[model samples]
Target chain A: MNNKKKIMEDLIHGIFLILGLITVGCVFLITVYLIISGVPAIRKIGIINFLFGTKWASTAQDPKYGILPFILTSIYGTAGAIILGVPVGFFTAVYLSKVAPSKMRQIVSFIVNMLAGIPSVVYGLVGMMVLVPGIRKLFNIPDGASLFAAIIVLSIMILPSIISVSMTALDAVPRDYEDASLALGANEIETYFRVSVPAARSGIAAAVVLGVGRAIGEAMAVMMVSGNAAKMPSLFQSVRFLTTAVASEMSYSAGLQRQALFSIALVLFLFIMLINATLNFFMKKGDVH
Target chain B: MKRSLYKGAMKTLMYISVGITCILAFSLIGYVLYRGIPGLSISFLTQKPSYLKGTIGILPDILNTLYVIIASLLIVLPLGVGAAVYLTEYASNKKIVGIIEYAAETLSGIPSIIYGLVGMLFFCQFLGFRTSLIAGALTLVIMNLPTIMRTTEESLKTVPNSYREGAFGLGAGKWRVIRTVVLPGCVDGVVTGCILTVGRIIGESAALLFTAGFAHSVHGFIDGLSSSGSTLTVALYVYAKEQGEFQVAFSIATILLILAFIINLAAVGVSNYYRKKRTV
Candidate 1:
């Protein structure tokens, strides 16, 4: 009986150990798979032409595979989203964390969480139906689905991450920091801006990084609203994103076109890894403080 | 006078920001429901689309969504819970724990599109699962693993060390102690994690778009898992973007919205109950 019990315990231990390593195994598989599949196209296309070539016509008699347009559109779109989203999110976080009454805070926070819970495709649908047409009429552009529309949609999509994260960071600020600032005769607003914001800077930075990640990774929303044209990004011009480049063509792409799509996904993976590193740095810095 | 002016300007800016945020959320919810509810019907819920009859329904998509959820959850909950158990109760080395945690974080940070690409390559091509609901569920299993692991790990941490000691004091084996004490204690976390994972799986589109090919047909759960089909989100995308069927898309969106609201409420309810129980 003792031996049987001991063996059973060992079997359970082994099963749990395998389960624990499953996450590591998954990460390893993704990395290995991406690298294996993503490298062949990069090798064939020449890295410079692949990364910096200005035109993309995969189906033409003589196809050109330059993805600079997709790269630039992604960067500019994410930047526009950050520029528009951060201030609103930052001030709202400050208000929610410091100034709002509890009942008001609860209601507002619930709304924000629901906003987070809303599916991205719905955002895309609304953007397509509303924002695209609004921008077309407002700017009197011939086409509604332009890079500008994508930027606006992405900015809204990223708001929840910025607000919730910044709220947590601001809420964690030592109350004494604000009390000290206020005791120096600074106003409540001044105390929050000067004392609380600076105290929670690392967390806020992490929030910004998280928002950037979300905006950059967002595919379906941008794909739906951004007219799927591979052009150099201008505010009023239709553009393709790295994500959309992969998604739009994967269904019908063949041979080198398909391989190049994998390369685009690899490039996207690298960008996300870079963002994750920066986020980790900020998160660790916040923990230390 | 200068400081008073500064304070007034700052407060005004903050209020405007809050107002904009609220307006954005309310308008989104209000607009989706307004456009969606009028189109929702019993036929929409129960019948499959029929081009021959000039009618459209999302019964297949709904069933597909349910299949994917059930399939993914049945697989993920065990693996996630087991991993969390090992991390919290069994893992002795801090280095191993750090590595496992970092892997989970990295997995969470990966974008869904890349998961789609990799899942297509790995599961569909390599494993020969092909483009099917099982493949999609497996992809989502990876995507949701980090969430479940984190939540379960957190609750396991809350299970007091003394309880484990008491189990051991009663002459229980390690597995016996965990079965009796630790697993039962973290039921709240598992429930919360399950809810959150369901929300994510429901919201997921890009990842499923490729791994699960966008064919809308109702099948039994076992059959559905083996065949290619569109989940609700993917169907929404197909109807809205590819087919240009706004009414169908809106109706699906409304159903998804209702599901998301319920999931969020349940999450909050579970957490609140856990908090109240803890304090007591």
Candidate 2:
């Protein structure tokens, strides 16, 4: 009876151990799968031609599989979104964390959560209907579904992440520091912007990095509003992102075309991994301060 | 005079940012509802789209979403909760714990589109699950595992070490103590995790698109898992982007919006209830 009980405990412990390892297993699985499927196309096209050549006619008679356009578009779009979104989100975070009354803060936090919860497809649908047309009318563009429309939608989509994360960081600023700032004759706004902001800078940096990850990884909404054209990115021109480059062609792509899509996904995966590393670095720094 | 001007400018900017945030939120919610609510009807909610009859319905997409959520939740709960339990209660080595936690963080950071490609490659092709709802659910299980694990681990941390001590003093084993004491205390975490996972599954489009191809046929749970279908998000994408069916897309978006609101409320309610219980 005693031996049987010991054996049962051992079995359960082993089961739990396996469960704990499953997450690691999944990470390993995804990395391996992406590399395996993503390598063949690169080998065929040559890495330089694949990554730098500007033209992308995957289905043409003489396929030119340069993805510089997608890469540039992704970089430009994410930068535009950060430029447009960070200031608003940062100011909102300051207001909520340092200035707003508790009740008002609670309400705003709920709104932020709601904004985060709204489906990406819904964002896309609304962008397609409103922002696309609005851009066309505002700028006298032939088509509203340009990189500009995508940037606007992405900026809105990333706001919740930027606000909530920065708010948490701001709230974590030591109360005694703020008290010290006040004692030194600094106004509330001055203390918050100068003292509290610097103290929470690492956390805010992490928030911006997080937003970058979200913006770059986004596919469907960008696909809908960015017009899915393989053009070098211009603010007012239709362009395809790295994500949409993979998504737009995956369905009907065959042979090298399909392989190229996988390669695009692989490139995207590398970008995400790089962002994740930076985010981790900032997050760890935030923890220290 | 310069200092006062600087302060006033900073204050004005802060308030304007808050105003912009609120305006964006209210306008989004209001517009989706305003455009979508009028398009919803009884038959529209109950029947499938029929080309011959020239009528459209999202009953299939709704049912598909339900099936995928239920399936994914059933699979993810055990794995996530068990992982959390192990990390909290059973693990003795700090290195293993760190590695597991790091892996979970990495999983959470991965894009859903990558999950789609992998799900398509592994489950749909390699495992021969094909482009089916089950494949999609499995992919979601991976996507949401980190969420459930983190929430459960957090709540497990709150399940006082004294409870375990007391159970052990009564001559109970480790597994026994965990089954009775640890698991029961993390109910709020599991509930919150489930609600969040449900919201994610509902909102998920990029991951489900390829793993579960865009089919609108309705089926029973078991059959549905084996067959290809589109969730509501995917359906909305197809209708609006591919078919020029704006009305149907808006309707689906509104439904998704309402579901998202309810899930947010449920998450808050559960956490609040647990907090009160702990306090009392």
Candidate 3:
């Protein structure tokens, strides 16, 4: 009986060992598959030129995978989102923790959480219906769907992530800090900026990082509003980013084109990993400070 | 005073920023309610999705969505909770614990598209499960694991040490102590985590697109694993993109928004209640 029990214990342990191994295996498999697919494509289109070129003619008999323009568009779109989202998110965190009534805070915070849970496709639908029409009518842009549209959509999409994380951070600030600031004759705004926010700096920074993750990962909404044009993205000119580039072509793409699409997925995966790790490092270091 | 003027400008900007965040979120909700609220009928909730345009019944998609969520939770919750327990209750070494925590957090932050790519290659190719509900649910399980682990860990941390001590004093084994004492005490936390995970799953799109197969069909409970089904989110995506059918997408959006909003509101409330109870 004891021997049988011991064997059962070993079997259960082995199950866990395999499960853990599979998680690690999946990550490695993705990296390897992506590299094999991407490297060959990069060689076909000279790595230097492909990485730096502006034109993206994906349909030529001998096509070019010059992703520099798309890469640049992604970088700046994320930058636009972060710049638009973080300050507002930070202040909302301030207002919720500092100024808002309890009822108002509860309602607003719930709204933010719901916003975070909203599927990207829903954002895409609404953006097309409301924001696109509004942009076309008010701005007199020939195409309502443009890089600017992508930026605005991404900014809104990332808000729930930014606000919730920052709110948690701000809530971490002890009331003692606010009391101390008040004792120093500083007004509420002064105290919030100088004392409370700084005290919650690490949390706020984490919020920004989370925001970056959300904005970077967003696909469906941006694809809808980004015009699907593969030219280099100018502020108002429409262009395709990496995600749309993949989604737009996936259903029909086959052979080398499909491989190249996976290559885009590879590059996208690496880009997000870099952003997350950089933020993680910042958060860790800030905590240490 | 110049300082007073500076302060006034800052206040105005701060308020505006807060207002902007509110409006960004509210506009989506308001738009959905304004359009969808009037069209929502009991019949709309009771029938299946159709390729036939103009009729707005989402019964099949709603049932499919619920099937996927419940199925995924059944797979993930036990596994996630067990892993959390092992890390928290059994593991003694700080190094191992830290490694587990770090891995879970990093995995949580990975983009769902990456998961889509992996699901396509690993599940569809290696496992021989074509895009179906099972595949999607398994992928979602991976997606929600870190959430459950992190949240359950939070709740476990809040559980007083005395409960475990008391159980052990009665000669209860480790598993028994956890089953009887720790698990019961942490029920609210687990519920909160479950709610949040449900919210995440309900809203997910890209990952499902790869694994759940885009072909639309209604599947019975056990057969649900084999058939292709569209969740409400994907239904909205298809309508918005390929068909350029905006109104249907908005109506779908309205349904998703209300579902997500209700769940989220509940999660926040239960989490707050538990948190307050623990403090006392």
Candidate 4:
């Protein structure tokens, strides 16, 4: 009976160990697969030309595999989204965290969660039908699907992440910090902005990093509205983002073109890894504070 | 007077900013519902989409979504729950725990598109699954593992140490203690994780597009796993982008919107109920 019980315990322990290691296994699998599949195209095209080339014509008689345009568009799109989303999100978070009555806070926070819950495709559809035409009419551009429309959609899509995260950070600020500032003759608004905001800076930074990650990695919604043209990004001009560049061509692409798409995905993965590192850094700092 | 002016001006700015944010959220939701509801019908939910019939039914897409959710959850729940158990109950080495936690975090942070690419290469190509629903479901299993593990780990932490001590004092083995005392206490977390994972799978589009090729045919669960099909979100993309079928797309969007709404409500209800029970 003792031996049998010991064997059962051993078996259960082994099962739990295997299950625990599955997450590590998955991370290893994804990294290995991406590197193995994403490298050959980079080797053939040469990293500099592939990463820095100014033009992309995968199907042209003499194809050029430049992806500078895609890279820049992704960066610019993410930056634009941050620029547009952060202030609005920051203020709303503050209002929800500190100023709003409990009832109003409950209603507003619910709306924010709903915003987060809406599928990205719905945003794309709305952008496609409403914002695209509106942008064209507003700017007198012949085509409505441009980088600007994509920026708008991305900014809206990222708001929920930013607001929720910043709100948490803001909420976690020790109440005594604000009380101290108020006791020192700082008004309520000044106390929040001066004391609470600075105390929660790391959390707010994490929120921005999260927004940047979301915007940079987004594919379908941007694809629907960005016209998928591999041109240099201009605010009012059609452009293809790094994500859309991969998605638009993967269906029909063959040989080097397909491999090149993998390389683009690798580039995107690297960008996300960078953003994830920054997010982790901020989160650690927030914990320390 | 000057101090009051400063306070008044800052307060006004905060209110304006918050008001604008609320307006944007409400307007988007209202607009999507308004546009989508007009095109929705019972037939749209039940029939198979066909070009020959020139009819737009999303039965296949709806079923595909359900199958993917069920398939992915069936696999993920065990692995995720087991992993959480190990982390909370079995692990002694801090280094191993840190590495495992970091891996989970990295996995969550990686975008779904990368999952689509890697899933295409590893599962579809190497594993010979082809572009089938199983491949997509497997990909989603990876995507959702972190969510389940995190939530489970959280709830496991909440299980009082005294409960574990009581079980051990009674001469119960560690495994028995966990099976009886720890697992039951963490049921709320597992349920929450399931709800969150379901919401994510329903909203997912980019990852599923490649792993599950967009074939719009209705099949039984088993057949659907082997074959290719589109979920509602992917179907929305194809119809809107490829087929120029905006009406069908809007109707699908409306259905998805309703699904999201219900999922959010369920999540709130579950957490509230559990919290109340715990307080009592």
Return the top candidate by lDDT: 2
Q: Which sequence of candidate numbers ranks them by DockQ, best first? A: 2, 1, 4, 3
Across A1-289, the per-residue lDDT of candidate 3 in tens digits comes to 7687667656655554444433344455666766876677667667677778777777788677777877888888999999988888877888888778899998788777777878788888778777777788888989888888889999888877788877877887889989998998988888888888888888788888888887877788898888888888788878788777777787778777777777778788888778768777767866664
Candidate 4, superposed: residue stretches over 4 Å from native = none
Residue B58 accuracy (lDDT) in model 2: 92
Q: What lDDT score goes with residue B242 in model 4?
A: 93
Runs off by more than 4 Å, candidate 3:
A1-33, A36-40, A43-46, B49-56
Candidate 2: list runs displaced more than 4 Å. none
Query: Can you write out model 2's per-residue Cα lDDT over B96-144, one digit (the tens) per residue?
Result: 9999998998999898999999999999999999999999999999999
TM-score of each: 0.98, 0.99, 0.93, 0.98
lDDT of 3 by residue, B101-187 (tens): 666666777788777777777777679888788888888888888778777777777778998999889977665677788777667
Docking class of 4: medium
Better of 2 and 3 by lDDT: 2
**Model 2 lDDT tens row, A1-289:** 9899999999999999999999999999999999999999999999999999999998788999999999999999999999999999999999999999999998999999999999999999999999999999999999999999999999999999999999999999999999999999999999999999999999999999999999999989998999989978899989999999988889998999999999999999999999999999999999888
| Weakest lDDT window of 10 consecutive positions for candidate 4 chain B | B9-18
Cα lDDT for residue B25, model 2? Answer: 93
Cα lDDT over the full model 2: 0.95
Model 1 chain A, poorest ten-residue lDDT window? A109-118
What does candidate 1's lDDT look like per residue over A47-90, in tens digits? Answer: 99999999999999998999999999999999999999999999
Q: Determine which window of 10 residues in candidate 2 chain A has minimal summed lDDT.
A: A228-237
Candidate 2's displacement at residue B51, Å, is: 1.4
Each candidate's fnat, listed in order, reads 0.78, 0.82, 0.43, 0.78
lDDT of 3 at B65: 88
DockQ of each: 0.81, 0.85, 0.51, 0.80
